[model samples]
Target: MIEILSPSRVDRARRTGALVGDILQTLRRRTEVGTNLLTLDRWTKELIEEAGATSCYVDYAPSFGRGPFGHHLCTGVNDAVLHGRPRDQVLADGDLLSLDLAVTLDGVAADAAISFVVGEARPAESVALVEVTERALAAGIAAAQPGARTGDISAAIGAVLTGAGYRVNTEFGGHGIGSTMHQDPHVANTGRPGRGYPLRPGLLLALEPWVMADTDQLVTDADGWTLRSATGCRTAHSEHTVAITEDGPEVLTLPRAA
Candidate 1:
């Protein structure tokens, strides 16, 4: 389903987005070498509950996943990319970590993700991967304007990643998000501009750009949820929920102070 947030609801979406962004930022600050993935999940759950917000993932049962996610945050380590279910693994120095989160507050929902290197050691490759995805995400957001097609956003993201010498995966990308976490008008990471759903004022889209260092194929972990790189290459992902407005595109998921 494609949803467009009403003016009043868009206001609520700002709050929801701020909560999601703040939680992710807080988690990033708290993460360090030796931190367990499970610990991050617990921390996220506590923060979400404290904010009086509901998790969009804990009870999520999508066809691609085994059943209820049963986790508050997705913890992707190194080669792991999407749908990363938090486990007992401890993060090591230089470990590349990705955290994806979504939540609803006051009947509105927002989603976002961030990738970073753990500890003081930052591998050059990991830094490059994270930087490229962040740039790609910015491109995608810059393309999200009223009357612009979804493909424009996809193409903008794709251009940046491909130019950076990374492989883009279309299996899972961005999507329309509003009252729910995932919605229609599937936004692939790479596509031809001037195609797909047309953008309109009030439309909300979660534009994510993710890339694998080597291959485009993905392998699901034994947990039946976490998606990892088929070639065991490090990966990175960046995302944000944006709202189309009469003026242009407004990023709802910026840090509260932003």
Candidate 2:
């Protein structure tokens, strides 16, 4: 269901967005050479509880995933990309880690993700892959506005990724988010301009741009939740929740310092 958040909810959304962003930033900073996936999950759980917020993923049950995700956050490492369920894995130098988080505070929801390399081992290609997705995410956010269509955001993201020589995966992209985690107006990573749902005031969208290093194909891990690259190629993902406003698209998941 698509929800055009009421003004009061929008106010709460800003706070929710900040919370999600802060969580992601915290995870990014704490993730290091010896950090374990389970540790990250525990940290996330504690943070969300401390903030008096709810985790959108902990109990998320959809047809595509195993019921009751039972995790506080998604931790995709190296070749793993989306829906990365936390595991007993520990990080190594140069491991690319992606943290995706969604939370609801005061009945409003916000989602965000960040990709970073661990330790001093920053592979140039890995760095490039992360940069491209982050750039594409920025492009998608720039295209979000009250009269803009989903294609506008999709096209913007595709251009940045394809131009960087990475394959875009549309199987899972962005979507409308509000009081609920996922909603209508599916936003693909790549699409023609001027198509799909029209942006309207009060509409909240989560524009995520993710890419695989080699192929667009994906494979589900043994856990039946984490999405990994078919070729085991390194991957990266970036995302943010935005609110459509008469003034333009107000990024709800921006850092407080921004």
Worst 10 residues of 1 by lDDT: 249-258
lDDT of 2 by residue, 125-149 (tens): 7899889998998899889978989
Q: Deviation in angstroms for 180 in model 2?
A: 0.8
> What TM-score would every model get versus the actual structure?
0.98, 0.98
Give one digit per residue, the lDDT tens place, for model 1 in 57-129.
9999999899799999999999999999999999999999999999999999899999999999979999999
Model 2: which residue pairs collide? Answer: none
Instruction: After the best TM-score superposition of candidate 2, give how far the Cα of residue 22 lies from its true spot, in angstroms.
Output: 0.8
Give me the displacement of residue 139 in model 2, in angstroms: 0.9
